[model samples]
Target: MSLPDFDTFRAAQAARGFDEVVARSWAPDEDVATHSHPFDADALVIAGEMWLTVDGVTRHLRPGDRFAIAAGTPHEERYGADGATYWVGRAEPG
Candidate 1:
């Protein structure tokens, strides 16, 4: 799928009840050890590639790919050589 503009992405997330949207980038070949967040996340890759691991399953993600993780899920991340950039929508559980 083609990538959406930030405005469009933010609007879509808001419509889906996400409270905030932001851009995030990782350095090339970076590895983020296992961690968890306090809120749910919905994200789309905007550039480069990454490996996302949740529940011990790893997914390779490239431009235009989307992923989601539930609040408090333990996950790990590794960025491709060229690094990665993405737009993420976050929502706190009600």
Candidate 2:
């Protein structure tokens, strides 16, 4: 699903009570092996590009692009040539 701009995304997350938010930066061509989160997550790309593979579907995400990760869903990622930076919002545990 498509996502709104950064400000809107942040606001929505706040409204949903996502108290844990962080900004992360990846190095050029950085790769992350498959992993899963214990809680739901929302990631918004702020700079450069990211290639994300989730449930065997790969998506190329650029600035202003966003994606969601359900709890315990396996995913992997690769950064673009120029690297990337993004904001991640995590839902509070129930």
lDDT of each: 0.96, 0.87
lDDT of 1 at 17: 97
Most lDDT-accurate candidate: 1
Candidate 1 has which clashing residue pairs, if any? Answer: none
lDDT of 1 by residue, 1-94 (tens): 6778999999999999999999999999999999999999999999999999998899999998999999999999999999999999999976
TM-score of each: 0.97, 0.85
Residue 15 in model 1: shift from native, Å? 0.5
Winner by TM-score: 1
Q: Indicate the worst ten consecutive residues by lDDT in candidate 1.
A: 1-10
Error of 2 at 70 (Å): 0.8
After superposition, candidate 2 runs with Cα above 4 Å error: 1-9
